[model samples]
Target: MVRKKFSKKEIFTGIACTLFALLILSLYVWHQTESVSLGYDSAELEYRVTQLEKEVEKLETIKSSLLTLDRVENIARDKLKLSEPKEEQIVYEHIEKER
Candidate 1:
């Protein structure tokens, strides 16, 4: 069996190469982790947007139903005991628009 002795330069080169490879691998792993985390956040935000849109639609439907003319007329006639104006009590006006 032959014994081989390595020089100081060779040992230092090997250590430096190993450290550089480790640093590159660490950077790659960190980048991949950030990408995955951002993907999850984007999906969560999209789901939140969809939920908000649905809520807005539901609120608009409720507003429309509440503002119906039939309901308002019923409330006005029955609750306020108001009657229609007579022909003598009515007046008409004409207005000109500015250009």
Candidate 2:
């Protein structure tokens, strides 16, 4: 039996098939590169989350410290100089409007 030579249409069809397969492979690689599954991007995100959690804990500690009775009383007495008033020394002044 004689060997049958490939026709031009058949050769072009083979090239098209190869190019299509290559295109599909390239698309797959592109998708995988953009996705964050088991990659450096995921690790970076996890690290950022951990840092944010630590900052939140620090802020909470500072907030609790500020709310203590000692801190409140110290600020009030030092800054405002408020004191208990004696009943006999207490006086009220009435202001008159100028015409």
Candidate 3:
């Protein structure tokens, strides 16, 4: 049997095709890794947003409780040592509006 010799053009073409296939494979792998990273980042951000929403709701509840009339009156009477005015000490004022 005679050994067949390869041409220079055939060898170059083979090498180039191999290199291109490797490049395409690398790019695909890189894109897959980047997609996974972005997915993890998005999930983390979503969790943080949920936590912040819960915190906002908790703060709103505390604010509402602090603003109640009974709480305010208790704080003023106990902490500030203030008292309501007697009925005899109350006064009324009248104002006239211009048309």
Candidate 4:
């Protein structure tokens, strides 16, 4: 039967190697966590961008409709009762004094 005892130098080298391995492992885990967090933030920003694009498209459609002659005529006729003047129609204006 034979048994080998480790020398002081060998034990110290083993401890140093173990510590280095632990440090590397901790750094790798931290990097992985940060990567996941960044991915989630990126996805959130993408979703917000998509929502804003949809809103912009809707606003563009509304703007186009508002700029049409037909839409303007409809609003003027319905809201303001505007009409074309006939030859027989007489117009009068009365001015009020501002106090």
Pick the TM-score winner: 3
Write model 2 residue lDDT over 1-99, tens digit each, in one string: 999899999999999999999999999998898784657888998999999999999999999999998888887789888766899776654433331
Candidate 3: deviation at residue 12, Å? 3.4
| Candidate 1 segments exceeding 4 Å error | 1-9, 78-83, 95-99
The pairs that clash in candidate 2 are: none
TM-score of 1: 0.70
Better of 3 and 4 by TM-score: 3
Off by over 4 Å in 4: 1-17, 84-99
Q: Residue 42, candidate 4: how far off, in angstroms?
A: 1.0
Top candidate (lDDT): 3
Q: How big is the positional error of residue 74 in model 4, measured in Å on the Cα after superposition? A: 1.7
lDDT of 4 by residue, 2-88 (tens): 989999999999999999999999999999999999999999999999999999999999999888998888888999999878976
lDDT (Cα, 0-100) at 42 in candidate 3:
97
* Shift of residue 32 alpha carbon in model 2, Å: 3.4
Off by over 4 Å in 3: 1-3, 7-9, 86-99
Give the Å shift of residue 73 in candidate 4. Answer: 0.8
Ranking by lDDT: 3, 1, 4, 2
lDDT (Cα) of model 2: 0.87
RMSD of each: 3.5, 6.1, 3.1, 6.2
For all candidates, what are the clash counts?
Answer: 0, 0, 0, 0
Candidate 1 structure quality by residue, lDDT tens digits, 12-61? 99999999999999999999999999999999999999999999999999
Reference-based TM-score of each model = 0.70, 0.65, 0.73, 0.57
Question: Model 2: what TM-score?
Answer: 0.65
